[model samples]
Target chain A: MYTMKWIQQDLQQYVQAKAYVDTIIVPLIPFHFSDDASLEKDAFQREVLSVFMRELEKEFSGRILLSPDYHYLKSADKAEEVKRVRSWVEDSWAQPFHHIFFMTVDSSWKKFEQDMNGTLIWLPQIVTESMQFSERQSVVHSQVQQVGEFIRSYWEDDK
Target chain B: MSEDKRPVSRRQFLNYTLTGVGGFMAAGLMVSPLRMAIDPVLQKEAADGDLTNVQLAEGDITNEPQRIDWEIDQVDGWYESKVSKTAWVYKDDNGDIVALSPICKHLGCVVSWEGSEDYPDQFYCPCHDGRYYKDGMNVPGTPPTAGLDIYEHKIKNGMLFLGKAQPREEA
Candidate 1:
């Protein structure tokens, strides 16, 4: 159940074991530096999404490759972002990933979800910034469990 | 200066040379053993000897397996961060505390207690429908090739401290 570490040795093993590792999870992060008001919200979402992805990776480390985060400007056009995300999918396809999922907390991505090449999973915004660590953890844990089940459902369809 | 530089006696010269070489040999012999004796004291483990306080009260553990979550400081190469960990904890028939790693042996998926409705008393992995008995033993003919890992645990004053999870031999 060892996940792929971003190192040469782990990657060499990944290439050797390509049949076992076929799924990829990409986190879509949005940054808004132009407006000070939206900065905190964007930052909060980024943090929450990363935690969610980490938990997901732990759940299915052997079969899934956690790709680097994909960052974009919040003010960027949805059409333009779709093109950029599709480019990423094309590059990822070179590695023979059968399943590619893009996880995001921004609701705006839902409008252009179908235009993207991979599946877009938009999680609801969680306002747990002020909550205690334990409280927020439980919240994230429950959501991550549901998301994991959802991903498994897709894999089941293939079989 | 000339008087002091008078021809050295062979006996004095040999005595000085022998003392210096003997001192060098003794130091070389002692250095290796000294470093070996102090090596453990200089090394610090990422998990502080692999035991982290899980913050669960001893009384809280019951016969039914309960999920426990805890955080530890992990150092990965040059990066340091807090990593969250989870375990399935319960008391066995003999009233002994048992902690098992929830990672499924098949494909690294997380297993849950009674996850599938059909398997009410066993740990189930939703990824490939893998099942394990209550004691963390994988059901025969399942996808998992090995049994679940057991964690080293210690009870201190009412709190439970857990160490690394050691893999179990297949039954």
Candidate 2:
């Protein structure tokens, strides 16, 4: 369902399912190329965020529109980005999406989280190199479980 | 040719040649089945569907439908991905275990158990307010024109092995 494009045919059905589920998730990511050293870590965190979003989407599909990854420079200003994010959420084509979540690994979003219209969920970067499969699964599962809980809470509040 | 320097009898030559041809044909016929029996060790299965183990004990299942999630390796064309499959599993009144697919037949929205307050003890799709009875039969006049699908399932060592969900005719 997280294919790169939501084509015309998908758009028609999205219109119909709009009444049932009114939420879209935008995974906010920071892309950095300031240096060879820090960019690697940023890339790693982005990959972890990708895994997290896919896991969450699989658990609650169709109900959760996994929007395209929102990428910005690591050094970009957060206060300015908040308005862009608000406009993106507002541009839902009048389809009545209630909740907009901004999923990120960058803790910078934490400082300005209140200013943004979307829910900013800043996750800790998962150390991917040394972990075994079972450990990784446990880590990812525990984190996604929390995300699911948050979604449920938001659903209740929305009602 | 090695030993029959003496003029061969017509019967002797005919008998020897026929025996050799018959032996060759007999050996040719046995080769295919022998190779088939050993082929499993030589090649991998490409078309076999995956069966995921939904780690639910046989005793845990009851008349009340329980939703269980499990992951399986899925092959779609050239891409291999881990797909999460969910089923509403429970034992029916007859004591037979049933696993039903939770997808609403109308437009593939995920249906929830008793999602609507008014539709007591029924599967409800928030989309179009589709409803299904406890038995996975779609209620008429709902947007869904067909019943929820049933997954092919088997119990192995007390664990549930689930296969593809096959759609049944509308109630």
Candidate 3:
């Protein structure tokens, strides 16, 4: 539990450092919803995510950019959903984010690489029983460092 | 001597003994009700107690009440388990911090604030259509026997905190 807290704090600092370049893009998975649940029929998850984003917008204001939550659709339909989400971001969001953080059990690196235009940050499934109790501080620290490095390298080359 | 020991003396003796025993039993039975009546009178003197302060702060109106959910371990002889609980904190109009329990007094239903359009600015219990004013008073025609339980509070810095509530004094 203590290690988890330390890791969370470190992640917050890392995200804050990256905040200078772009708003943090966090893709929340609707894991609580069953696979059979119809996305269009059930708006609970969308409403909750909307409320969370609004609250975050209030807290961070102009200092950060938060893209609307993506990945509510299935893996087969993910490509289309990603495109739709990207368009929504371009139209609705004030600015584009530099880093895209994806939390998933499966490391679909190639799929995300092809879909997203920004730097891809893969987060290991942290909610599982094994990861929940394991010494995950170093593992999380390394992942954040890798993502941060990618962002720095990508944006610096762009400039 | 056997012939002289007749029915009259035996009946007289039996009557006196039965009366004595019945009187004793009657006095013993009356003790419980007597104690029940007198106990509250004696208890009233000690009931003038001090209110517990929950240590809230000034100017801390967050629009939404801060929810603190916790679990307490309980033991009953051999059995043990955790009991889940929650409390909501808000500031009253007088600037005094107040905490109201979510449990309704009527039938122990959970009452939520601003739940319906009819009572826009009050707590509403969906279970029985009961309503309470924001300050915790029960609506006169409502099913609740008493008002919402107002938890004890005190001011510290700028954050509102809470303590357990006592039953409201009867009107």
Candidate 4:
């Protein structure tokens, strides 16, 4: 089992070195906004992501891997948007880093599943309504532990 | 002939004192404007000869990007201003350390690393699609005309220190 204590320490270190990680992560966020809407949210997202990336680089150097954040798509949108996202990831993200992790949040999941091409990690929705705060914490702890374990196992197997 | 041979009369003494006071007043009146005019000239001369030495010890090089901020006194015509700038320091592929300026030369926009999906592992300028390779060369056919400026670097002890980025001299 992945220990929460270890994950927390690693995450703390990651946050401390946000600038380096953000150097790689900032340009990936979807930035389209309506003329009527304020760009504050998008700006904040960029700033936060920049900081996060910098910290990641500082903590993990080039060893830390990153995947694009899931882009939630609705049925109403055209296929072009989906294709653009995939192309962006491939041309921009994958070219730099060979491996990426993604979570699917689309309604059909078929398009995303196909586009992800086996690179997707299906994130199960945690039922927060039924769970207490402590339970939610435990769930998060377990999830991170699993992630760490998977990374370790993958590294070991590669060797 | 043996005793007092003081030659100044009272009128001559008064005239001398008044002339001295008048000269002092005149000089005081002219001082501010003269200082205002001469100050910039002196400052420019000082700025032209100004050179700051930065010390780098051997230990400062790590896997992380180091932020280094510095100021240089620059003279623009008659005005002397301290130009403040920063650089990100990191180790390149050859294991030799380098410092790259955060500022983009194209339209003075700031370039951040990994800014766009189209160009990964390179510094990006979001304003005009400007791109810089990892070694800080501006991508050809991009907005930037010149490569990213390289700071003067030296190693002392166990640390890395950087100086100002001057234009590349032809060897």
Candidate number of the best TM-score = 1
DockQ of 2: 0.20
lDDT of 3 by residue, A1-159 (tens): 000011465346435544342545555444334555564433443443343333323223222344445555444466665676566555434544544444333355447565555445555444322454224433443454454444345444544
Q: Which candidate comes out best when scored by DockQ? A: 1
lDDT of 1 by residue, B62-144 (tens): 99999998888889999998877889999999989999999988777789999888899999987667899999999988788
- lDDT winner, 3 or 4: 4
* Per-candidate count of clashing residue pairs (backbone under 3 Å): 0, 0, 3, 24
List of clashing residue pairs for candidate 3:
A23-A65, B56-B154, B56-B156
List ranges where model 1 is wrong by over 4 Å: A5-10, A91-96, B1-50, B75-80, B169-171
After TM-score superposition, what is the CA distance of residue A143 in candidate 1 from its true location, in Å?
Answer: 1.7
lDDT string, candidate 3, B42-116, tens digits: 776444232322343445455555544444455779999864444566666665556777676754545667755
Candidate 4 segments whose C-alpha is farther than 4 A from its true place: A1-159, B1-58, B63-65, B73-80, B169-171
- Candidates 3 and 4, the one with greater TM-score: 3
Q: How far in Å is the alpha carbon of A74 misplaced in model 2? A: 1.4
The per-residue C-alpha lDDT of model 1 at residue A89 equals: 90
Tens-digit per-residue lDDT, A9-118, candidate 2: 66676676667557788899889778787877778778778888877765556567778888888899888888888788778636578887888888988988887877
> Sorted by DockQ, highest first, which candidate order results?
1, 2, 4, 3
Sliding window of 10 residues with minimal summed lDDT for model 1 chain B: B40-49
DockQ of 4: 0.04
Q: What share of the true interface contacts does each candidate keep?
A: 0.62, 0.10, 0.00, 0.00
Q: List the residue pairs that clash in candidate 2.
A: none
